[model samples]
Target: MVSLSDYLILSSIIFCIGLAGIFINRTNIITLLMCVELILVAVNTNFIAFSHFLGNEAGQIFVFFILTVAAAEVAIGLAILTLLFRVRGSIDVDVTNSLKG
Candidate 1:
């Protein structure tokens, strides 16, 4: 049977992978955004695991709120990235440092 430690270990592994993706894909905005989503998923996994173990609904409720916020964040980030791409012709992180419009 799966235990809390197992769940936590999986969550940590996922979180680490997300962190590594974000750091390794330094020049790709889309990949970085995806990595952020991965990290959020890892967090939600922890919340769900703890909620189940503790017999409380609070963690699930918090996870719901987190999902809502994450959805909004992705939408906004995509929109901004689209606009930036249109203006700059590429979504290079280095180019954004001197963004002028």
Candidate 2:
């Protein structure tokens, strides 16, 4: 039988992997976005696990809202990335500095 600690540990591991990915790969915007999504997923996993173990729906509800926000964020991020690529011809994060006025 899996315990709450087990779930927490799993969530932490996932979160760490996502964090590491973000730090190690700073060249591509797509990889950064994916790492961010992975972090969100890790958070969602923790919410679901705690909600189930505690017999409360609040965590689950929070996860739902988090997912909704994540979806919107991804949409907006992709749109901006598309425009950046169209203008700069590259999706490199370092190139984004030129956008600063």
Candidate 3:
């Protein structure tokens, strides 16, 4: 049986790792996207774990919504990144900041 505390701890660790990635990698848009995905995955893990622990379906339902939002976020984010790359000729967010039409 999976312990709720262990699940929560794992979620926390994953979230921290994602945060670190975001802070440490400030160049590539792809790396930022990956970090965001990791954070979302951590949230999903917590939601499912809590749902199971509390014997409630609401948490799982919320997780579904979160997943949907994450997907939408990634799609829109990637589209924007593509546009940025097209305009700047590079995928580095730091360099893309100087680009203006």
**Global lDDT scores for all candidate models:** 0.94, 0.93, 0.91
Backbone steric clashes in candidate 3, count: 0
Q: Candidate 3, residues 1-101: lDDT per residue as tens digits?
A: 87999999999999999999999997788999999999998999999999998999999999999999999999999999888878788898688555477
Off by over 4 Å in 2: 99-101
lDDT of 3: 0.91
**True-vs-predicted CA distance for residue 82, candidate 1, Å:** 0.8
Misplaced by over 4 Å in model 1 are 99-101
> How much does each candidate deviate from the true structure in C-alpha RMSD?
2.4, 1.8, 2.4
- Displacement of the residue 55 alpha carbon in candidate 3, Å: 0.6
Q: What would the per-residue lDDT of candidate 2 be over residues 1-100, giving only the tens digit for each residue?
A: 9999998999899899999999999699999999999899999999999999999999999999999999999999999999989989999988878655
Q: Judged by lDDT, which candidate is best?
A: 1
TM-score winner, 1 or 2 = 1
**Can you tell me which runs of candidate 3 are displaced by over 4 Å?**
99-101
